[model samples]
Target: MQTAKRLFFSLDRQTECVADYIEPDRYSFLEQLPENERYIPRGAGLSYVAASFGSKSISLGLSKFNRILAFEPSGEEPTIVVEAGISLHKLHLFLCPQGLRVPVEPGHPQISIGGCIAFNVFGKNQFREGFFESCVEEIELFHPQKGLLTCSRNENTTLFELTIGGMGLTGVIVKAKLRLKRIPSPWLNVQKIPFTDLHHMFQVMKNESQTADSLHSFNDFTSFGKGLGRGFVYAAAFSEEDTAPELLMTFKSLERKPTRRFALFNRLTIPAFNAAYRTLNTRLKPYERMPFYRFNYPIAEMSFYFDWYGRKGFVERQMLVPEAKLDPYIEKFEALLRKYRPQIVFGSCKFFSGKQCHLRFAGTGIVISMEVMPNAANQGFHDALDELNVHMGAIDNIAKDSRVTKDLIASEYPEYGKFRDLLAEYDPHRQLASALSDKLCL
Candidate 1:
C-alpha cells in the first residue's frame, strides 16, 4: 500500500476534504486495509459530489488495479471482466477494436467503471437502454467483515441490488463483469434538429427518443423570455459506413484541466455566448457523420468549457420528474428561471424510463440538467429550486449535487427509508463512510 496525505476536491470544486489516501495495487491488500476503519473506494474521482472522501475517512484509490482480467466473445452475448479502476475511455478503446461496446455510457470518458456502477449513471439512450445497472453481470465486493463476496442476480441477490447504486456506502468494489453489445461499426450518423420553444423541444424529444439509439437535447439557458428552451435535439445511431481513423482515437488526457482564475461564464458573457452558440449550431448541417467516440464524449474535445467556469466552479442541479407532472413542474421551473435570469449558463434535457430503485436516479421521466455559476443570485435560485423539486415531486440526483441537505433527500426519495434499512442490515457497524454518506446521514 502506497499512502500519502492528499487533499481531494469534488468535480465542481465546491467541497474539499483531507484524508489519508491509499493506493492499493493488489486485491489482498485492498481487502485487508478496510478492517475497523472509515474508508471509501475512489475510482477516477470525477463525481460532482463528495462521494469518495471525508475528513475522518481514508480515501482508498483503485487506479493501479486497472486491468482486463477476462474476455469471452464467443456466445450471442459477449462479456468482459475488468478491474473496477478501468476508465470508460480505455474500455471503449479495447471494445471498439473487437466490435463490441457498452450500451449505456456516461458522457465523461475519464469516469471509471466502478464510478459508473456506484452512481448508476445513465447515458443518452437511458430512455431505451436504462442505466449502468442493466449492463452489470456480476460484482466482486470487499467488505471488511464479509471478506470478499461475489454478487449476482442468482447469488447474494439482495447484496447485488444494494451495491449497484449504493453510493459506495455498501463496500469497496474490487472488480466487475459487464455485458457488452455488438456494434456494426465504430462510426455514427448524427442529426441535429432545431426547435422553436420549450414545448416544441419536448415534442421533438419524445418523437426522436422512440427510434434513436442515442438522444439528447441542448437548450439556450440565457433565453428566458420568448426563446426559452430554443435549441437543438441531437439524435445518433451506429453506422456501418467507415469514417476517418483519427476521429475514432481516444482522448489523450484523462486528467481534468486546471480551472482559470476568473469565470468566463458570468452573467455578462453567458447571454452573448449562448446567442452565438445557438445561431451557429442552428445554421450548421442538419445531417452529419462522425466517429462514435466523438458523439459519446463531446466534453473531451472542449475541456476548456469546465475550466472557463474558473475558481468559483459551478453548480449542476439535475432532476428527474415524471411525465404526468412535467408540464406543471416545468411551468414552475420556467417561472423560476425567469426570476433567476442570466444565472444559468448551460441547460440540457434527457429522457429516462425504468422502475425507480432504492435511491437510484432512474424512472419514466424527463431529466433536466442546468449548470449555474455560484453567487448570491445563483445560490438563492438553488434554494428555491430545492423547494420546487420537492413540491413538484421530482427526484434530485443525489450524485450530482453536493449541497443537497438531509431534509431534502428524505423528502424527495420515497425509498429513502428502505435504502437506509438495507444499508444498515448489510453494514451493521456502518464501516463505510464518505462526505456524501455523512451529509445524508446514510
Candidate 2:
C-alpha cells in the first residue's frame, strides 16, 4: 500500500476530491490503520454522487481484497460467501457455470458487492425482488474502535440493518454471505413494448411488474411537443429451455478509445440518438432470447458512454414517488423537462415495492432517474425538482446527486434521528466519516 495525492470523481464525474489513498489486501491490514486516523471505505465507487467522496480522510480502497471465501452451489439453498471487493461481474462468472446467480441485478457489473450493500442498490427487478439488502444473509464489518463484528438477521439484527444502507460510515465491510438463485439457463426471454406517452408507459410498467421478472422503461427525455415521454418498456424473465444460441458466455471486450472531451450533448443530438434507437428497436420482433449478461448489464456494453458528458460532467436526480401520487408527479416532471430542456444524456423509469431500509432508496412507488448535464442557467430546473419532490412526498436516492438537505431527510424519513443515534453509538468517536456523511449531518 502507498499514500498518493490524486483526485477522485464519481461516475457522473461531478464530485471531485483530493485525498490520501491506501489499498489493504487483508482484513488485518485494514484493522491496523492508525486508531486516530479518519478514513472512508471505498468499493468500486459506483455511487454517482458524494456518497463515496472522502475529502479529509484516507480513502481506503478495497479492490485488492477480492476473494470468494465459500461456495455451496449444489444444495437446496445455495449461498456464497465472498470478500467485499469482488465485482458483481466476477461473482456472476463464478456462479453461472453452476446454474446459480445473485437475485439483485444492479446496472453496473463493475460495482463491488460491498458497495451494493452499502447503497442497498435497487434494479429493474426491484418491483419484484426488493433492494440488494433482500439477498444479504450476513455481513462482516471491521470498525476502527470497535474491532471486527459479524451481523445477521438472527443475531445482531440492528447492526445488520444499519450496515446494509449505512454508506460505509458504520465500518469497513470485509465479507458478505449472499443468498443465490438457481436458473435453468443463462439466457433471458426479453420483450420490448413501445409506449407513446408517460402515462401509458407507467400504466404498462405497473401491469407488467406483476408478470415480468425484471422490467424498466427507456424514456425519451430529449423529446418535446408531440413526442414527449415516448419510449420503450423492456421486460425480461429467465428462459426455461436449455437452448441459448445467442447467449454470450462473456462480455465483449471493450476497445480503448481516445476520449471525446469536447463532445456536446444537446437537443439535436439527443433527439437524433433517441429516434435512431427507437427505430432500430421497433423493427425487432416482440420477443427474443438474449444472454442474461446482455439483459442485466446493458451499460457495460457501452464502455465509453461517459465521454459524452464532457469535462464538466453531469448529475443524476432520482426520486421515488409513491404509486398513488405518480400521475401528478409525472405531470410536474414533464413540465420541468419541457421548460428547462436540460441536456439529459440518459433516463429510465422503474417500479419498486415493499418497505425500505433506514437509508435505502426504495418504497412502493416508481423511481424516475435522469442524468442532466449541468449548466449555469439551470437554477430553475433545480428549484422545480426540489418542488416536485416536496409536492409528491418523494425521497431522494442517496446514490444519486440531488439538492438534498438535512431538513428534507428529517421530514421525509421519520426514522432519520434513530439512524443517527445508531451511528453515534456504533462509532462514538466518529472515526468513519466522508463528505456525504458530513454534508448530510449523519
Candidate 3:
C-alpha cells in the first residue's frame, strides 16, 4: 500500500483538491484502512464533479485491481467478469478480439466500468439500449460493516438498484458481471445531415433515433437570428463491410492532456471556433466510414478540447426536457440565451428513453449538453439557466454540474427524498462518502 497527498481534477477541470490518497496493490491491503473512517473509491476519477475526493475523506485508488477475471462465450448472450478499476478502453480492446462488447457506454474512453455503474451512464443510442444498468448482470460490493455482498435484480435488489446510480455512497465496488452482445462490425457508416434550425434538427433526430444504430446532433449557438441552432446530426450504423485490420487505429487507453495557462475559449474565440467547425463538417462528405470506436469515443482523440478551457476550467450542464414540453423549453432556452448571451462554446443533443430513477440522468426526453467558460460575468447566466430549467420542468444532470444545489435536484427529481431515506437506512453513519455526497447530504 502506498499513501500520499494527491491532487485530483474533475473532468471539467473546474475543481482540484489535495486529498489523502491510498493505492493498494493487493486485496489484503484494502483492509488496512480504518473501517469506520470515511473514504470514496476512485477508479479513473473522471467525473465532472468532485465525486472521488473530499478535504477530509480518503481517496482509495483502485487502478491496481484492473483485470478481466473471467469470460463465458458459450451462452446465447456471453458475459464477462471484470474488476471495477478496468477502463472502458481496455475492456473494449479485450472484447473486440472476441466480437463481443457492451451496448451502452459514455463518450469518454478513460471512464472506468465501476464509474459507469455508479453513475448509470447513457450513450448515443440510449433511447434504444437503455442505461449502464441494462448491461450489468451482477455486482460485488464491499462495505466495512456489511462485509461483501452480491447484488443483482434477483438478489440484494435494493442495494443493486441503489448502487447502480448510487454515486459510490453504498460501498466499494469490487467487480461486476456484465452481459455482452455481439459486435456486428468493427466499423460504422456515419451519415451527417445538416439542419437550418433546432426544430429541423430535432425532426431528423427523432426520425433517425428509431432506426439509426447511434445518433447525436451538434448545434451552433454563436449566432441567434437566422443562424441560431443551425448544425448537423451525425447518425451512424454498423457497416456491412470490414476494413483491413492494419488500416484501423489501435485501441489504447487515453491520456489527459495538460491545460493551457489561460483559457482559449472566450467571447472572441468561441464564435470563430463554432463557425469553422460547422464549415469543416459541411465540407466533408455526407456519408463516411470509420472505425466504430472512434465514433463512440471521439474524446479519446479530442482530450485537448477540454484542456483549452485552461485552469479556471468550464462548466458543463446537461438537462433532459420532455418531448411534449420541448417547444416551450426551447423558446425559454433561446430567450435566456438571447437575454444573457452566455458564450456557449459547444452544444449537442441526444434522445433518451427511460423512466426517471434515483437521481440518475435517464429519462424519456431530449438531452442537451452545453459547455461554457466559467467566468465571473457568466455567473448570472448560469443562475438564470438553473431557473429556466426548473421552470421548464427539465431535469438538470446532477453529475455534470457541481454547482447544482440540493434544492434544485430535490425540486426536479421526485425520487430525491426517497434516495436520501434509502441511503440513510443503508448507511446511517455514511461511512462511504465524498465531496459530492457531502454537498448533497446523500
Count clashes in each candidate, considering only residues at least 3 apart in sequence or on different chains: 0, 0, 0
Candidates' RMSD to native: 1.7, 2.4, 1.7
Worst 10 residues of 2 by lDDT: 251-260
| Residue 21 error, candidate 2, Å | 0.6
lDDT of each: 0.85, 0.80, 0.84
TM-score on alpha carbons, each prediction: 0.96, 0.94, 0.96
lDDT of 3 by residue, 232-343 (tens): 9999988767743413433444333445578888788999999888877777667788787788887676656677888777899899998889988888888878878787
| Residue 260 displacement in candidate 3 (angstroms) | 6.3
lDDT for each residue of candidate 1 in 71-115, tens digit (9 for 90 to 100): 998799899999999998889888887888888899988889999
Residue 241, model 3: lDDT of 70
Candidate 3 clashes between residue pairs 3 or more apart in a chain or in different chains: none
The regions of model 3 sitting more than 4 angstroms off are 246-260
